[model samples]
Target: MTQIEENLFSEFWDKLNGATGKGFGKTVSIDQDIEFYQELKYNNGVFAAFKVHRMQNDMAARLLDENGELKSFKQWLNDVQTIADHQVEQWFRTEYDTAVERAHLAAEWRQFEREAGVLPNLEWIESTSVTPGKDHKIFWGVIRPIMDGFWNRHKPGDRWGCKCGLRATDKKPTPVSDLPAGESDEPAAGLDNNPAADGKLFSDSHPYFTDHYGSKKNILLESDKLMTKYSREEVRKHFQKELKGKSLMLQASQGLAKTISVSHQDIKTITGKPHKYNYMKNTCCYWLPQLLKKAEYMGWSPDMKGTAVPGHGDVKNWHYYRFPLNNEDSFLVVKERMNGEFRIHAIQDKEHFKENKLKNPFEKR
Candidate 1:
């Protein structure tokens, strides 16, 4: 696989596994869950695209080289499409099952927390389907603190196809100790007993925990969707033909929409004060340019009908638009000045906007 393919697969795996971890820690957010589902769909699309590229190359080779009686191009195309479809379907099913399992585990953890009033200690429960490994047998009855890094690495269902589970207990956990004269301190050969230099108790290389924690440096950003579909040269040429001088501005705006770089001025304008949820600011930044792009593409003029400014009379030249972001309605209010420049006057959800009765800023009368 190419570097991009490998990175995509790695990201898909991490997001699938990390769902449970985030749930256990109560750090899961709607934004994270939405991104998780989006990444899964994106990865499947990438795989399908790659398959098409490979099929095209293979068809060319078969036509040129004398191999066993070559099939018709039509036949070859159908076979390739069938295989690609199957692969994509299988990928979706596998990932979807894993995501469901992780979500269930997270829900269980939440319920456990609500009833137990503390992180529940886990008791490793070995399955009876297969002969238990020596390490599994040793840890079978052992109870471990939920807060320890060991659970992060060695939680039940850590391995692929693992049928093991953990039973929650409110009692104190059994401490790790030497079994006999020659027994090793570690539970298994590859699993490490010490934390890494980064203060992570789990090894970065551990298969179960490797993808659980780390920055996603290789995952493609959403703004890259347009660039990925069309090359930079192609996009630039198209823009030159259509937008002329504004092409650069469009390109820069689209690029900025993918990142979490919100301006302090925009944040203050939207929230009146610093808001606790940074995700809201980031979401606004991402969608603002997207909304503009959609309007331009659809050739829809901005809606500038002003609403009553609560105590103040109706203000003119204020534009309003609403779009769904993270499964919520994001209402944006902007003002077009005399110079034709647009300024983001305010942004909030539909409910919040209605509740606050916010309006356009004005000079003291």
Candidate 2:
């Protein structure tokens, strides 16, 4: 392999060894490992770094899950790398500059972790006692600029990744104590042992599962189709009524649709209500979970194996199996889906949801 490739290989090796122990390198100090990873993150694209970083986190999550059932770190590393490589090929394209793709992938991964309630503990988000691997910091640093570039244009609070959550519209990070039931205490690290299995993550007390679950795309599509019965203005009005004085951005972008924000209103011309207002920062829409699920269902998930767009997290994040319905509404739809019964946090069922007979309503339909 080329020197760069060899270094990448060694970085991967070190990560696996300390984490899964494929024995790719000598028992270097953590400092050495971190340094190697930094080069990999900066030199490599976001997707590569993401793939590498995710493997590390996934290993930790698994260890937590099985109570440390790992047979050997080496075996785990080999096994994980093989599987990760296969999965990466599915979403990535080979045409784009690998570096750019890496950038996008890294950003998306960070977004995903934050939305899924894992980012808080992620090396990038918080100051943990454990020093981050070089690749880990490199990956975040690379994506940080990209994220910063879009901070003002897009509601910074809203850009959390897929999987239904309040931040889809709001970018302001919520405290872990504030996250809905079953939501991870640490947003970046993911769950320890399938929090869903414990009947907590998706219970009646659960925040996002109360209203729906099948396919987010299906939900958005269905909602969009339902909107066809109305007009854009009408849909906005629907949210106005549903959100009870909340303002939403009608961003008709590609790849994803519907980035909402909650805010109070201010008055204007000859109208009953205010023309504009300060959107509530707590609730917003960055990524559509139901919509993503639908895209995944439709085989429209963006390619991750090949080259991706530059400036990760910017418009044109990922292209799914299928293209957007049109530029106006790509993989997402703009609707007040999180209203009332649909609002995840509104209907969380924590302690004894099953007893309350609040089985995942989405599972049935």
Candidate 3:
């Protein structure tokens, strides 16, 4: 990694230390609270480092064209990289602030809920203190129970960079017609859960960890191990080993569709990085394995990139599969090519398939 990327990793790691109150290269004091919090800090730090690495690669990819020709320096600048950075910054900012807010609000909130629980007629409006996107602004002035299911999911800090908070009021609670009942009302993949109530600062479904180096479970495990080992250098070594040209041959789970197999190099087609795919996330530096293993079959068609007689053994065909991840609007659609060798792409989900001409290319009826 370059010095700039190393700096990014350290900057994020230090920022997260505020949450767990653990010093770098220090032993856990054996205090349960500090230990638990310290583990969370390590988890967030490793995830942060993974993304910083992914972002740098994506930015570098923008420097070249599909034909392998160099692009102008100005053209190398892309919006997706910025969006990636913004999400990372927002995720970190919210995580750090949520930790602080929970500490400050815990005692007062418990006492308030204890007294307020006695009253059957209390409601709260979710007011956004910061300007939010249409997705969140739509909930402005919307009322839900002060301490109920809605608050658990729609509470302040629910979205990355969300500043929405509940304002307790005497007004009666009313349901919004536009609101869909369970399942459909979930927030974005990583933003749905409440850290204050659940003590999980990051969602398990966030693409960062879901597709992170060594996988989510492994990453968390490594993060926990880091707390005990207290070696930042070792942390980087383990993370790097699991990622970057690891020559992995991953397979999809058996189901209605034929099992699919992908290698680390095929993933490089989307971003010059072997670990990542250019899906809703930067790419599947690690999540590609999970996406393939968990994916449900969509459909198949003749490969548009090559000519093949229908039903003939030309060995040119396109296989399609859809896997739900992150959010309702951001499903990952995988397209694989078969002709002795193999290639695939995790592109935009169902909503964008048509606009991108990604929907079942030359599908056989």
Superposed model 1: Cα runs more than 4 Å off: 1-86, 89-93, 110-116, 128-138, 178-219, 222-365
Candidate 3: misplaced stretches above 4 Å?
Answer: 1-10, 19-43, 49-147, 167-186, 231-365
Between candidates 1 and 2, the TM-score winner: 1
Residue-by-residue lDDT tens digits, candidate 3, 61-101: 57768899888766675535575657576656666765454
Cα error, residue 246 of model 3, in Å, equals 50
Please give the lDDT score at residue 207 for candidate 3.
73
Model 2 lDDT per residue over 226-299, tens place: 22222223334544565576543333233233243332231110112111110110111212232233332111
Tens-place lDDT per residue, model 1, 12-108, is 4344445434434444343233333333233333332343333333334444325666778776666567544653466445434444444445455
* lDDT value, residue 169 of candidate 1: 89
Question: Could you estimate the TM-score for every candidate?
Answer: 0.38, 0.16, 0.40
Weakest ten-residue segment in model 2 by summed lDDT: 275-284
Deviation in Å, model 1, residue 278 alpha carbon: 14
Which pairs in model 1 have colliding backbones?
none
Provide the clash count, candidate 3.
7
> What is candidate 2's CA lDDT for residue 172?
45
